[model samples]
Target chain A: MILKSKVAGKLLRIMLISSIIFAVISLVTTFLFVYNEQLYLKIYKFDQFISVFYMILYYLLIIVYLVWLYKAHKDLVELNTMYPITPKGALARVMIPIYSLWGMWNVYSTMYDHFRPIKSTEKLGSQLKVFIPFYYFLFLITNGLNRVLLKSNTGLYEVSDILYLVSYSLDLILLFVFLKMVNIVMKALDLLMVVKQDIIDDTQDVSGQPKVSS
Target chain B: MNLITKIKEKKEYSLAIILLIIPLIAAVVMMYPKHEEFVATGDITSVEELGVEGSVYFTYVHEGIIENLYEKFSVSLTSRNEIEFSSLDQHQYENYTAYYETSDKYKHNTIVNAVQNAEVKTDSQTIKISEKSQKIMEKSSDYIGDSFGLMIAIGLIEEWNDEDFSQNNQYIISGTGTIEYDGTVGSVGAIRHKLLSAEMNDVDIFFVPKDREYYADKNFSNQVEAKKVVKEEQLTVKVIPVANLDEALEYLRKLP
Candidate 1:
């Protein structure tokens, strides 16, 4: 269970890093186009291949992350009775197009709330809370604007270009937020496991006997 | 959260905000239009100003020195008022035409100076040239600059100067160069392509700009490149390098 959680944590970090790189390249391409149309067109032709390669890598990473999340959530179900959303529901919400945005918000919020200590002394939960709404808001705005831009016949290229750039920039911010939140959650999980082990060791010392499971 | 704690919590957000701001600044900077400067500038008259329209024809008589043969090629120049240099193969045509138009104006002025210098008495003060071709006509819409085409224009003008059609039909002459106000021929590009074209037509005498040792590069310079292509192709045509219009005319006069 611990190994599965670690793998999930690692995949999330990888996705965040890749997202940052993709965003940077996208911005650079946009800047080149704006600065010199001719030069940008030439470079863009070559960069299309690179963009496709990155997209393939991104999708593969996402799939691996989802598998890890499913396994970790399954393990959590065995240890705890309370789950705001089922493991399958969490995965489905993020995978479905229209529902993915809300699903993402639900998954992150549930994870944050579930992982909070029962005593209410844990500082990790609050750190994770601050950026969740902000990330969700940015994601919704960026995606919603993108859909509108696609359908609208607005010939305002420069304005649309700026809006698209803002969307990518917001995405980069969200990715960073996600990376931080994952790291905090992972650290908290590790601390909780260490505390559980300590309690078990203390009980064994007092009884002068080792606890065993059938 | 306390003020200090709130500020600390917002620190990560600030870093991300800074990252986003850089590209925003760049987008704003690129929104302004960039001014592009022309590479080469020359003076040439547009065909519109000269009142020449549609396709015009020019005849060149080729005299074979070895075989004692004469062949006349009827060359046609197509002109359109549509101003677009659409050939992707020769991207330099646009810039070349810009320079060619400027050079042509100077050529016109030179002809006027020559006519005035000769003390010729004529009722018409305006020195008009029907030497305009389709290329120049298209310059009305799309500018095309080529030094070789400019040379051809000057050659047609020189042919017109004699007025005796028999004298103009005596020899077939083909050359490529940018003409200056003083009639000094400047070097042109694509010397190999021009040579191949000349050879394909079995030209009697091919004229190129005289090589300047200082300006000569391994890839460029007329004489050496021309010699290499002629020898490789085993062409019987003669390659003569001329520095100016005087030298070119002198060569033609010497031609039997």
Candidate 2:
């Protein structure tokens, strides 16, 4: 029972964190609406409100999750006291909220950027499956460079820095799209191999099982 | 158990793999630099070393103010910010008179000496002057107008119009070097020295006179001595009926 409860708590935390990440990204993008003015002055005004509402809803959900997290911890502590579960396991369950929040915050901005209107919405939606990890790697590289440059007295030429940042971002986006394509092909191959194996195994399995010599 | 065979025997995903590779290849090729010459010339230091110089031209025109033949039209020249010239109108046959004085009892004849023995040609007198002269005229609208305070309208045209130039032919004007005067002629003299020191190239100006008899030997940019067909007194030194840029300049100089 203690183990089951701990797994359920982890799953809940992951779900809440994912939702928060989505909400935070939507909010950040909404605020950067000024950047979109150049593409078309007439943006759908409701986009901003929708993002705001989503953020609020996510925050509320997070609060509810925190309450549930507290209850789950309490229940785990009781379970640990009654059963053979260790104190470490109970503490770990209690700390899942913080880990989840941290994970959500780290990736929220990038995930939100995938939805920007510059690209075709449908294409971006499909591409983002690959885009996320690709962009994470790109961000790590660029952010490291940014920090190194910050230490030097000779700051980067503003235009060059901006251009580099944009280029890196674009490269990541392209890589993400490529990875997504690869992922789809791999999945299709896996499915086909499974089906072929299943057909072969269907005939072979009955004999191999030493059929219940009933 | 036979992973290698399974991978090889699986229907080749050739279409999907090729589709993926094409875009990747295209992107890589497109990202390479395009224009080699422009990239080579992108250095700005050399371009800055080559000096740039320009001239300002001013063409003065007036109308609806010619009461008597001698009563010349008063013209005021100004810049975007301040007025530069305010002179009394005068008419002339051979040479007009310009009365200028520096002081209260001051007496001065600001003369625009004519190019002696030089024949003039050109329709608009202003066009025959230096390149600087043309530049000043082109920017005249910026210098003129009530925006700069003094609204000195000489004719119905609020501003100098190229269309009116051929009609009256009585356009009073003058030309001077754009020198920073430190309140003295000595400073003006210094300007000439500086210009010469820099080895500034002159923008050649020519005038094809209506009466070609004003010159015996005719060549562009060549100075010549010639006699005037009309007497000095009979010749109207007014800027009106100015043949070309050279004639206009000569007429301006002849004005007292």
Judged by TM-score, which candidate is best?
Answer: 1
Give candidate 1's error at residue B246 in angstroms. 48
Model 2, span A38-117: residue lDDT tens: 43224433333333344344444444444433444344334233422233443343346665334422332322342333
Residue ranges of candidate 1 with Cα displaced over 4 Å: A96-102, A118-121, A149-159, A202-214, B1-256
Tens digits of lDDT, candidate 2, B1-256: 5866654454223322333344344434433322110000010011001110111112221211122211121111111111122223333311212211121111010010111111122233442223422332343322211110000111101122222321233332212111111110000111111112122212122111232334454421111111121122232322122233334434434534
| DockQ of every candidate structure | 0.02, 0.01
Interface alpha-carbon RMSD, every candidate:
17.1, 23.7
Judge the docking of candidate 1 as incorrect, acceptable, medium or high: incorrect
Report residue B249 deviation for candidate 2 (angstroms). 36
What's the lDDT for all of these models? 0.53, 0.29
